[model samples]
Target chain A: MSLLSRKIADAVSAHPQKGALTVDDDRYEICLELRSADPEIGVSFDGLDFRALDASPRSVETLKAWGERLASRLTYLMEPLVVLEVDRIGTEVELRSAKPSVRESQLRYYELRLESSGAAHLRRVLFDRDTRTRSTVPCTLGAEALERLVEDFTATAA
Target chain B: MRKIESDQNRFRQIVRGKIKSDLRKYITHGEMIGKTGGELVSIPLPQIQIPEFRYGQKNGGGVGQGPGDVGTPIGRSGEGDEPGAAGDAPGQHLLEVELTLDELAEILGEGLALPRIQPKGRANIIEEKDKYTGIRQTGPESLRHFKRTYKKALRRQIASNTYNRNDPIVIPIREDKLYRSWNPIPLPHSNAVVLYLMDVSGSMTDDQKEIVRIEAFWIDTWLRSQYDGVTTRYIIHDAVAREVDQHTFYHTRESGGTRISSAYQLANKIIDAEHPPIDWNIYVLHFSDGDNWGEDNRQCVSLLRDEILPKSNLFGYGQVESPYGSGEFFRELEEAFEDVPNLALSEIRNKDGIFDSIKEFLGRGR
Candidate 1:
């Protein structure tokens, strides 16, 4: 196993479920979760929660491969820093931009969700400030773009 | 004149129908809220026209059939197609019809099937209004009764042998001037006060505040229509709570942890000082994102149970959804205050949820 993956696996074994650890790179805070003997890893940065696989094994090599896969997908996230949040309730996963766009009085945000089956979906939302109305549209992201988002969410800090 | 009045009444009915058909859109979208002016709101209606009489000139020329040829083209057809500067006259436009608040409230009531609120207890507040009782000899010129003064002048002219019976002309002097006088009468006013408490913490965004704003507008509109005198107060809270004006209540934002009990405490104090349960019909609406400091949730429940709900005719708690909020406070309240008639709890997902949330709050007719 790679040196970094070995360290993460050791840290996960030492800490309790839902515990956080800043490994080789202190810039990224990795959160470890265990459900039904399967591991879920996430990262917290800039008060925003991001990245959590539905389920995986606690293998050191698997952690390394997943981290590398995420790192290779860093193509999106080329804009200014905006707060985002990921709160998983029950089996549903909700990852949304916490800071909405302040255009005129209207606010807009992008939200991504992962169903229990691990399928990802995206939505573009618009909220009218004057009227207090909201409208949402389903959106699509290319495979590479989705990968880039996963990469940015899993490892990066802003 | 009667025919013209009848036509005008028919036109008004048409406008009311159009407004009623689109009332759901207005309530859900809040497009009419910004158009409110005093007690009247201007609504834009399309495809409605006002009838007018078109007069023709006495000497206007007309074409004779004898001079027209079978193959003749209309004069200057090419000239009409030529490009020119924009015309001075305006093009077709949407008509804006102004409806009073009472009228709008009636539309809302009928459109949503909302039951009219029953005022609790007897009317306790007294409002004094001016009644035009009689005429006086001396007063402000703006209030002068010209018709009465002219009749008085005609009577005096005939009595003094200065009347021109054939001409029938009478001019009034300064001594003939009369003014309208008023007497103050106290009437019982059914008074209601809506105490609005909002959580302006970091978790609550402008979007959520906007939902609060739209809901508040509808609630205020319905309550104002029900009560003779309705007074509104605004309170904003983060970790600390304070009373503010209406403008500041919706616009203000603070980046601090939420302590909902602070707002309830202030509302309790306000009720004790200005509005007593016996004399005032109190409505307490608290809006938050359902995020609070862990220990503060218990305090908020206690405050609601002991202080706010007991005094309020209806206590509505709306949890506006926010991305940053944990949304645990809603469950806590539901668990603590199950089946409490005076307490109404609703979860507002977004702007679209406002219509039903308002119905839920006022449907009780409290």
Candidate 2:
């Protein structure tokens, strides 16, 4: 394999969750959510599709499946995945977990947020780890609203 | 196939002609902005019909040999007509042609007579890039220099006294292989900073906000295309100045008296702290309804003349006319910066005036 492909493969192996990527900018709005495994809450980028990125990752099968379902809904790709990583130390996901944690740069920003709680809430919704930028208002939407929007879009896509 | 391709090109030319003739109308009405995907933008190209050479029916008495009665409906069977019920003369057939965004931008640039921005900062930034430094005796032909290799082999053969005139077999030794060289130098790229200041006062209606939103998108598109890495900052003010997100800048509704100077102050502060004139080319664009506090005009004028204009590459004041606005500020700006080189002022009367205003603001190409 070429060096670039090898590196990308390595990255995929190291990371969890990946999906298809589609490129379309027709009428679409991406709705994101912040939640943990316990709550099971998720968000959506309404009208955007992602079937193309389905096989890019190695170990992130679960993430890939979610991406598959999400990709099935839309006919176009809107934006590339903006990611954030929650480190083991102070991540919302880490904090919520039962296991003990240690020092590490686990939390990285896909998008930054206003407060820690809000940032945690955003990370959970967007399912990304890190928060970036100067303190800015975190995007807010109710769990029900997120699900409703996603479900409505999923129905239309079907 | 080549003829068909040429015909296709002619059709596209017709589509572009239609667009150019009514470019201002399209910009104003926000038509032809429907985007499809990369390399394809859906445009409502009007009245430009697809090329069709309809053959006459075999039995019809058409121009060439046919068997039917004299002039028995020369064309295709029938596009059925019910002659009445508010008669239908051939309805305008608008073909939606998908032109690349670059084509659209080029057309817009030509129609508006906008001067291309001369790139500035690219020459100054000390970018250290590695290129093949210089020729060497042995490297790879992906980097090979044939002349250098021949010269090296000839010189080596000559220097070592292996020169023979009878049989000139100057075979290149392993050491004779040479490679071309490259050097890394710092390249400069011009930088531009765009400061968008808007009035979030009560007088500015949602319609006005929508106008600003749409105009800003096109302005950004054109300006970003003009300059690499264009720095954009949003400042909104009602009675005071504050920074806001992209979403809030357009959607945030506030109800306070107008104080145009507040936005100016914030913009000036941003300029002072982040973008100095030496390192950055600054552009300040202010969108306001001319309803400033009567006493603040002098302060605004002084600021524009002294601090803002000096530091800015272009200081554009767009006075959006609103129902409640006195619109006195536009007149004041006209009188104040009448001969100013980089300062441009445009009056946006309504949605229809957006194209003209954009042209007026960026036409000088400062």
Candidate 3:
């Protein structure tokens, strides 16, 4: 298998719920959805509410090829995945969770609020259950950061 | 009206964005060329979302409410009897958007950062044009202005106190007749002529021709947008050279020795006879597999240096890679004319290389 296919397979395996990746021949619809859980990131295919998990090996290979093709066309997949919902009051930023939380989470929702302090950009991972718990941390807004966060979240659940 | 105009402008911006992002892909592919109309080309963009409404299940108060059986067929019988497995994913859609040649050229220029061309010599040709910019008292019946004539007659009647409040009938006399008058204006038009020369020898494959075709389409689009009138001439050569139409230039295949100078000679002859350098912005573009005969490279260089390069605004030479060819002609051109201002040379190894090759050729925008 190619390195891209292996990466996708690893991503799916790390998730707590079953996950599937579907990509069409023309690469118009490329989506990765998690079944039986509220996914941290959900790609809508034609605005249809659907879940696909336990994809075949052929589907994984097709998704890898599609990803390569899209990259050649200079279209980055992570740009669409990183959707930020920002609300600001004065200088304080209130970042709301754009997507629902995964299953088996103690918190009802989690928001990654980012704000600038002097030269450093600080973030607060706000967990809302009954009472809100905020943890200030340093984070960078990039593909690698998002990937690491998702992996860390899944690892904690596991 | 303002809101609609804003919405239309927003949609146009989105389309331009899509085109700009995929400009390189379009340059490497030739499928869009076949979908081109007179002044517009249709491009298929993937993953463009369209707004729609989705309905949800209502409360349990409708018909067929009594669920007494399980594993029974609900509606039609052969609904799910297809051969393939049922796919739960939504199908992909390609949205076809039509853009004018001018818009496509603008996107290409912005994407490639190509400079605007400065035509050399007397690029503009002045032609006398008649424009109706004034109204006169008398002229031909075909040029008569009915509205102006009626207003003039009404004013004359009101000034002479011949108007009636009840009748309000004002007839136009000879003196009150108004006609549209035209002045001869000298309109300057910039015209361009492109000479496309390609080697269709045995070493050149259909894939190489496809790359050339895609590149030529973009070059044509850009040139046509820049000039008021653009003329394209195609020349195909193997061991000999002959002028042909666009279709024959791209589709013809010949197996013989390569003679690159023959094409340059014919192009020079055509330009000298028809398109003078002073009056037309001439562009000579040549595509080949860089497999000229061993003895003809010197002749080709001499011909280009003495005849073609001096008269043309830009001379672009693209060398398409071929397995059978020796690929020595490009080295000769580079060694001979390393500092020629009008000469642009590019090596296109594959379809993807076409994007960079086009930029190299038109980047200077000579």
The two-chain DockQ for each candidate, comma-separated, is 0.05, 0.01, 0.01
Q: In terms of lDDT, which candidate is stronger, 1 or 2?
A: 1
Q: Is the docking of candidate 1 incorrect, acceptable, medium or high quality?
A: incorrect
List of chain A TM-scores, every candidate: 0.37, 0.21, 0.22
Question: Where does candidate 1 clash, by residue pair?
Answer: none
Write down the lDDT of every candidate, Cα atoms only. Answer: 0.70, 0.60, 0.67
The order of the candidates by DockQ, greatest first, is 1, 2, 3
Candidate 3 C-alpha lDDT tens digits along B18-134: 788888888888899999999889999885665344556775456565555666768677886778877989877688889999999999999999998886555555677999999
Tens digit per residue, CA lDDT, model 1, B6-86:
998888888888888877667777677899999899888876777667668964676567565878786856667868888
Q: Encode model 1's per-residue lDDT on A1-158: one tens digit a residue.
A: 43334455455445334433434433323332222111233322211123233432223333333333433443243222222222222133333454556678666665444333333344566666566455663233333333345335444222
Winner of 1 and 3 under TM-score: 1
Query: lDDT of model 3 at residue B300?
Result: 97
Which structure among the candidates has the greatest lDDT? Answer: 1
Task: Specify the poorest-scoring 10-residue window by lDDT in model 2 chain B.
Answer: B118-127
Best by DockQ: 1
The residue-by-residue lDDT of candidate 3 on A30-62, one tens digit each, is 234433222344322111111122222223223
Measured as a fraction from 0 to 1, the native contacts recovered by model 1 come to: 0.00
The residue-by-residue lDDT of candidate 2 on B91-115, one tens digit each, is 7667788877667777778888889
Query: Model 1, B103: alpha-carbon shift in Å?
Result: 1.1
Model 1 score (lDDT): 0.70
**Fraction of native Cα contacts kept in each candidate?**
0.00, 0.00, 0.00
